[model samples]
Target chain A: MSPDLLLCLLAGLLVGCGVHLLLARSVVRALLGFLLLGNGINLLFVVAAGPRGRPPIVGLGEESQPMADPLPQAMSLTAIVITLAMTGFVLALAHRSWQLSRSDVVEDDPEDARIGLRAIENDMSESDFHGGVDADPRHVDPDEAPPGTVPEEDDGSDPDPDAAPVGSAPGEGAEPGVPGSDDAEAGLDADRPDHVDPDPSTPEPPARRPGQEGAL
Target chain B: MSGEMLHTVLTALVPLPVLLPLVGAGIALVVRTRTRLQRAVSVTTMSLVLVIAITLLWGADTQGRLLVTVGGWLPPQGITLVVDRLAALMVLVAVTVTFAVLLYAIGQGRGAMDRESGGNAPVPIFHPTLLVLLSGVSTTFISGDLFHLYVGFEMLLAASFVLLTLGATIDRVRAGISYVFVSLASSSVFLMALAMIYAATGTVNMAQLSVRLAELEPATALVLQVLLLTGFAVKAAVFPMSGWLPDAYPTAPAPVTAVFAGLLTKVGVYAILRTQTLLFPASPLPDLLLWASLLTMLVGILGAVAQDDIKRLLSFTLVSHIGYMLFGVALASPAGLSASIYYVAHHITIQTTLFLVAGLIERRGGSTSMSRLGGMAAMSPGLAVLFLVPALNLGGIPPFSGFLGKVGLLQAGAEQPTPLVVALLVGSVLTSLLTLYAISRVWSRVFWRPPSVAPMTEDNRLERRYERRFALAPGVVAPTAALVLVGVALTVAAGPLLAVTDRAAAELLRPDGYVALVFGGGEVP
Candidate 1:
């Protein structure tokens, strides 16, 4: 029942190196780590199959000698195949990442990034009721704004409010010519005015109001 | 059929659930160019599997655990597929959900396929991969050997990697990378554990391990238990290991997200349940599991509260609810186990229904972001209703399966009323309240409020264009509604279902029946 020291050492080394590589940010490196880890486990499987013996072929070895357990070898073969398939899939994914963003370093989720920014700015308690009204005004378009409401630069302290709509113009202008864009935009435009009609009960707060930490 | 005849027939039917989908996947891949043929093959295969799963459930319930040895090989040596009530129930629920999701995906039509391929030549990868995933899931449920279970894990993981990153969009690719790495790491841990188990016991079969594992030194048994639990914990997205889920799942296309959200982690929970009950019946690590479950609940719900996107929010809640199952498992009582099994079945249907509804919301409003979505209640009352039932079901509202499952778990905890159990009870109740808050937040923002001007993000722009092309089809909505009804059905059928789960839990606690059945001579009667 004593496992081979050399084989155990090899498995340990492989697993150690594999884990180190897996923690890397690069997808390709992680793939390498996976392959190493797979091999390490495969080696561990070999060791776990018990002390080395004659090839597991029946009647090929002397009857008195013990045969190597064939089951771990079979299981490891399956593991090797799975590892190979996964490697191909990960490589394809890494390639796609490179194609899409010209980098293979896993990018942070945008929503997570936005949340992190909000945390850093100490603005985490913004109520869901504002309904994107308090979102960066840059997301809103000027022409879509109601006629009288369009010129509200009176607060003036935060430049982002008045400048947002002006900045949104070119983006909206470029989008209109695209097929199907109009129908989509029109549907939203119809909804936009209703959203903009300020709630008398909960008056629209000044754009970019300071974080109300306990708002929730 | 006579009782003995029925037993034989049922035992024979055991392998079909795994075999049929695989065969169907192969055929679907061959006929990939013909989308219609592929769809028919996929659906027909799953429908058959669904039928077989139902029969197996009946057989397992009446005739007791139906056992099949692959290639007619005997126990402790051959790969065994056992249909105990638990496995049969899992396979049945999983197949049902996957079948519905398949129909939903098909209803979505070419636009859905196009979204996956990013408008490239239609790859037809979806049907084949989904079938393979189904087969993998069945394999895990029925597998009676640890190595076979690992193979099943790899099969589903491989297929899921393809589904999750189907379009190769930057966001999906980013998410897929992390997902693939985490999954691979866990699989490695599982494989390592298998190695140690085999080395310690000289066999991988569950029946034999149930006997041999107890004879090992306490330290050796504890090491093996910790290793196996660690691997499953990662797969289950237990608190510390859960960071990858919200990031990865939200980026997939909606049906893909729905199925993954519903079934994948539950599969991990199933494995943990099976092992803890059968192989390590007197688990040395229930305290560890109890703590893990508590944190998984609290941390996951808090994370859900912070998410603005509907899919991401659901993803966090998915992680949170896995704790409930673990909570039941940790209690190590028949009632606890029964409640966990019921909760797993309930959560699978409810979670999938909600995600499908989220998909509907995305289509109707052109975004899943709570900020960008609003007025869905006014715009589409039917869609609002579709979203509401499942939302309340998930929030543990009275008369829903969610509430039933939680009440069962809490009642089980109260049986002991130890200090730790008391804390878990409080934590779980708190978690349920927070879940309601988060779900209600989604309901009001996405359905009730006035529509906001969504930012012109490139992703949603493309989404809107596709949404315009395929205006909310009945095909998509019907399957989602059907799944919603399925969740409601679980609530309605609670009496019989709980009876089945209680019987399953009783069998799980006593491994003698399983071990004897597996090793007892070939004649099932």
Candidate 2:
């Protein structure tokens, strides 16, 4: 049971554990784990190069025998610098993520999730259309927007007899005329009205008939 | 002159490709004003490097082999630079294409493209990073040892990560993160492979490894070979391990994608060629390599067939063409290796051209999706003509470089007198036709039809005039000129290039030539 052998085993164990933890959910824990892993490798490098020697920096012209290998120590120093920089960057990223989303659990980006869902729905509809089975839940009528607000042009062209009341974000099958055209504010606001929220709100339709909802 | 002095001078050359761009990049980075000056300096530096690389190639060809050991130490103790024919040729081609692309980037005018694309201006760091990347590729091709190869790979990877995520758009970010992760993972595997080879043979020097590897027990040697291949396969984007490339290549900024599509995977192919020829010639891996390449060819083309997006389809084609290069290497014959080398040079130019032109498509037609794009030919006849030439060449149309390269490979396969060779030949031909079909489909849909949706928006900023006489030059003209010229050169100079490739093939097949140069005493026989 040589001490050097035990040291190597411990370092290897630390690296394995550190890597495992680094892959976990908690950012702070991952950073700590990375530090431990780096230290573990540095220790392993020193031991593997050999043990029981004086430190490498020479003092005066003193007689030297079995000086410790300087290369591994140098490598460790570089590794430490790199690790420090990486850790700082990772911390910044974590902070930014928290500020943006208030959590660091690494959730799916909303827009990207929309795209992925679109792709999946496309696939589902494609298969259902081909298989001649029940219709896919994602099958939007060609004339309508895909479960979102319809464009203004669509609203103008396809007038809805039972449309929602005026003074709202343009919805599917709205009236043909400009809303509040007779009001003096129409000329005042050539662009979007000042009062309107940039992000349009879609009033959630009260629970629909299950059969109609599922028909998509 | 003393040998040490000459060696020092030569070693100085080893760092030239790497340092010059960094020097230029530093200038570009700090100099905030006078964008024109920055462009001039970057272009001048790159042009100088291209010239130097060409001269070096000439010297290498005439002088047998060029070895430059850094810091004056020799053998297993110091980093070495060995410029054999293959390395010299790689540096020459890489320098040529990189310089051309840089010119195109400058000529195309980032201001215009950014305005047209309705985006924030592109960072000037793009050119600097690209130049830095070329430096890495040049060194990777010339480095004499595995460790240096690993460093070169890292240098390239880091630059490529920056390139891939250039705009940091959401899509680009997602793609870039996956790309960086997969690449770094492969690199870690490469590092482990290096360690294993060093441990097994007690040497990492390519020259020394070449001689000592023969002495290793078959099993240990086999393990090292397989590990090395796996590491390279990830980089080479070989089938089954190549999932990352299709996602990554298309999402990058155009010029960046062009160079990456052009040179990066070829570096991996170069590594595989070098290692298999030098370190593991008798390892019984050639048969397996042939089969893998055959599958790569088939699977890659099929993947291309299934893709609707222009970039993804081209990416699949890029993956598939790698099989032909591997085919040449797997044959273990001079013709095969030489053809592969030639094909690599051709493929780099062709693939870069393809991706560059694809960028033009995105620029002129708006979206890269075939469904969204059409009537490019009617709008920009020059761009249409430019795209047609490369597209046909990519499909292995006669007299084009692709045809010549494929013919050379098929000839080598024919000489093998084995069923595997037959399959390789048939597979090569079939893939060529399938690829042609895909290219034609893209051509008809994108170039030959009326605009599918709305006409491309007018953005004068993106267009660059090539000449006063032709002042109405298409927006794609400057961006695609370099690639188009490369395609033309490949077609016109096919004879001379193939001859050079033949010589290279001969050198690779006969281990004696390479080993003798590396060992450097006299003839082994």
State residue A49's C-alpha deviation in candidate 1, in Å. Answer: 1.7
Model 1 earns a TM-score of 0.88
- Docking quality level of the chain pair in candidate 2: incorrect
Q: What is the TM-score of chain A in candidate 2?
A: 0.50
State in Å the error of residue A99, model 2: 7.2
Best by DockQ: 1
How would you encode candidate 2's per-residue C-alpha lDDT over B366-429 as one tens digit per residue? 4576644555676566667878998889899998989989998998888887988898899999
Clashing residue pairs for model 2? B112-B461
Which candidate should be chosen as best, given TM-score against the real structure? 1
Give the worst 10-residue stretch by lDDT in candidate 2 chain A: A207-216
Per-residue C-alpha lDDT of model 2 across residues A1-216, encoded as one tens digit per residue: 123777768877877877776665555566566667766766655564555666666773335666765644554565456456555645654553343234444333333354457576775421212432122233322322221232322212323211212223243132222223123122222222222321122122222222221110
Give one digit per residue, the lDDT tens place, for model 1 in A1-216: 999999999999999999999999998888898889889999999999988889999889787899989998998999899888888888888876665455679768878998878878877445664434544435453323311122222212222221222113222232333433234333333433323322233222223212211010
Docking class for model 1 is: incorrect
